[model samples]
Target: MTDAAAPPGEPEAAVTDGPVTERATCLLAPNPSMMTLEGTNTWVLAEPGAREVVVVDPGPLHEEHLARVAATATAGGRTVALTLLTHGHPDHAEGAERFAELTGSVVRARDAALCRGAEPLVAGELLLVDGLRLSVVPAAGHTADSVALLLPADRALLSGDTVLGRGTTVVDHPDGDLGDYLDTLRRLRATVIDDAVRVVLPGHGPVLRDPAGAIDFYLVHRAKRLAQVESAVEAGHRTPAEVVAHVYADVDRALWPVAERSVRAQLEYLTEHGLI
Candidate 1:
């Protein structure tokens, strides 16, 4: 789910399929597209010298990718004790069940239907797995079920699709609410400051070193887009398609369809708040 391009000066590290931090390693999935920047990031997280590990967002249902993630998580006598999904997007959670089966781990997600062998994730839930502390932070609006994991020990955030490494994410209207998304961003900005978060281990693209700055950019970008959408609507761009053509003209045509979802979300927000 792509949207507006990332703002300038947002730091992006060169992402590869390897260890990103002392407690986290990334396994880039095989699936890559305009929607998924590089690919869905299958993150393997564990404490140093710990025998148990946690895997997050097991990418697509591709057999090879799942196998790789399972292998990476279980390497050197480590056991994959838990599987967590950021959301139910196929690109992020489709392979979770198979991954759990492979590692004998239980899968947990905000959505009950997506959970396997475990209860759904709750906001503010602290998961203590093998000395690793991960706090479940509700991050709805990328999808209603999206949840971000905060690895406090490392001062890192496992930001599903709520925040991306290289570009803005789609609100994906109806299921995604712009109002909720805006609120989420504001909350995340505060979290970044209060927690002193150092890095964002995103689901796509690369790791973000400036969590606060990136979030601020997202907020500013959203405000700008909302203004553009409002202007487009007032300019007699009656339909979403017309609005997309007008407001997202700088974006790729192929991505207009995806951008339309966010435009609709923006329109809904505008209407609800009497800003349109």
Candidate 2:
């Protein structure tokens, strides 16, 4: 299932369009629809005046998409020098191997082994490919392995599923923790308040210009939702589904299933804290 033949949708290429040879290119994943928000976004960061590029999130194991990524990097007079994964989710890493094979680039990530045939990306790692300097920042919570990339020159942050352009992300249980997620959000807020980040290139949805406001809203929203869930549980909602019914009474019923996952995570958190 390469990008080209990726079931009619799925980002067929790692990088589509951006400032061209200026620096970075953004390719939207075809895996769009209501559930995924918009779709996963694969970005290509190239060094100005250089012929080498860094690929981010190969996007699903689709062959056509992989070929497109290879071709796009070539079109920019750049070769894929490295592959970086923000996380190990299938949508972001599944196509990494095939794409790497196509471009002969090494994979760089926090857990390189999660990325087929690549090395792990450690914190404070500085990747200078073709002259572009990328700083790796560990952004856990969305997932324990999630990482964020900072392009200091552009004051930009490449936030994977740890944050979204629209709406708040689920603090899924087992791998995701509400407390940890809040801490991560606070860290991001620090970046925003410090003016270290002016723009956010999220994994899904459009790029966000108001990173501070967005993060603040997410924190407030999550806190409110957690309170609501707590109140619902206190009101006799025993299961996740029941909590969803009470906490999300006005939300679309279709979203209940997804809400249930979050509710369950909250329940577990509460139980661990002896609040249940």
Best by TM-score: 1
Query: How do all models score by TM-score?
Result: 0.97, 0.87
Runs in model 2 deviating more than 4 A are: 1-17, 20-22
How many Å off is the CA of 130 in candidate 2?
A: 2.1
Which candidate tops lDDT?
Answer: 1
Across 4-89, the per-residue lDDT of candidate 1 in tens digits comes to 66644555555668998999999999898999988999899999999999999998999999999888999998999999999999
Q: Write the per-residue lDDT of candidate 2 for residues 87-196, one digit (tens) a residue.
A: 88888888888887888888877875775565688876888986898888778777778888888777888888777766667665667677777788898778666747
Where does candidate 2 have its weakest 10-residue lDDT segment?
Answer: 1-10
Clash pairs, candidate 1, are none
Give me the displacement of residue 231 in model 1, in angstroms: 0.6
lDDT of 2 at 122: 88
